[model samples]
Target: MITLLLADDNPRMLAALVQLLQREFVIVDALASGEEVLAKSDTVCPDIILLDISLGDLTAFQVSDQLRRRGCPSRIVFLSVHENPEFVRAAIEIGAFGYVFKSQISRDLVNALHAVAEGNQFFSNSET
Candidate 1:
């Protein structure tokens, strides 16, 4: 089973995502902040990380940078409400495997996960 770590500041969003994804993936960990993600990542070693870009205290980009600097091999997927072209470009430039917008989660997230798991990039259509 694919392992996933989820990080989102909103408890509801986190819970909803967990519920939505748990059936398809093993939820290695679910965190409410980037700090928690950074703190727990080494222990969990998830195969994929679904990160909210607007995480409180530390942005997902910052967390991704830190994880990359530490040589974490998990594929990072930005799960955010922001659909700006700049954000999509930045995520791709940062080497993230995917970027799925909140509005398109139901339609795109599973496909994104599958694509990324296969060593491919998955960005929302609008972003591309």
Candidate 2:
């Protein structure tokens, strides 16, 4: 099974994602802040990390960059409500494997995960 680490500030969003993805993926850890993600990443060593763009202590981009600097091999996927072209572009530039908008989670998230796991990029329709 694929291992995943989920980081989102909203408790409900985290819970909902966990519920939605637990069957298909093993949730190595679920955290509420980018700080926690950065701190726990080495230990959990998840296959993929679903990160919220707007985090409490650090932005997802910052976390992604730090993880890369630390040589973390986990694929990073940005989960955000923002559909701004800039945000999508930033995520891609940061080497994110996927970007799933919250509004289209039910429709696109699973497909995104599958694509990323297969070493391909997945972006919401609006982003494409």
Candidate 3:
């Protein structure tokens, strides 16, 4: 099974995303902060990460940059409520494989994950 690590400060959002994605992946962990992602991710090394942009202690962009610096192969997908182009550019610069707005979860979350899992990048139309 595909393994996933999720980082979101909101418990409800974490739970909901876990439920929505469980069928497609084995959730290694659902976390509330970017620190948690940095701590557990190296050991777990999940196949993909669904990372929230506004993680409590560290931002998702920082988390992604650190992981890349460490040569972590797992793909990072930025899951955010922000639709701003600046965030999109930052995520891309940090090598996030996907940028998904939380509002589009019902329609696009699964597809985005799939695309990222396949070593491809994905973003909403307005993101580019």
Candidate 4:
């Protein structure tokens, strides 16, 4: 099973994601902030991180960058409501393996995770 670290600021959304993903993947931890993600990522050593693009204290980009700087090997997959092309491009530039739209989670989330876990890049179908 693929190990995952999940982070989102919205409590309801976070809980929903946990419920949705737990069935398919091993959820190492579900966090509520970018700082908490940064603090626990190394300790938990998840295979991938399903991170919300907008976090309370730090953005997903910041967290991803720091994780890279710290030599953490976890792959990043951003979750966002934004469907802007620039956001997708930025996620790619930051070396994200996948970019999943919150609106399209039912259609794309699991598939994206599978693709990313297989070392392939995945973008929301609507974006492609």
RMSD of each: 1.5, 1.4, 1.8, 1.2
- Model 2 CA lDDT for position 58: 95
Per-residue lDDT of model 1, residues 5-35, tens digit only: 9999999999999999989999988999898
Alpha-carbon lDDT, every model: 0.91, 0.93, 0.88, 0.92
What TM-score would every model get versus the actual structure?
Answer: 0.96, 0.96, 0.94, 0.96
Candidate 1 vs candidate 4: the lDDT winner is: 4
lDDT by residue for model 3 (1-128), tens:
77899999999999999999999899999999988888896687989988999998988889999898877889999998898889999888878899998878887789998888888898865532
Please provide, for model 2 over 11-100, each residue's C-alpha lDDT reduced to its tens digit, 9 standing for 90 to 100.
Answer: 999999999999999998899999999999777778899999988889999999999999999999999989998999999999999999
After superposition, the stretches of candidate 4 with alpha carbons farther than 4 Å from their true spots are none
Order of all candidates by lDDT, from best down to worst?
2, 4, 1, 3
Over the stretch 9-35, how does candidate 4's per-residue lDDT look in tens digits? Answer: 999999999999999999998999999
Q: Candidate 4 — number of clashing residue pairs?
A: 0
Candidate 2 CA-lDDT value: 0.93
Instruction: Give the lowest summed-lDDT range of ten residues in model 2.
Output: 119-128
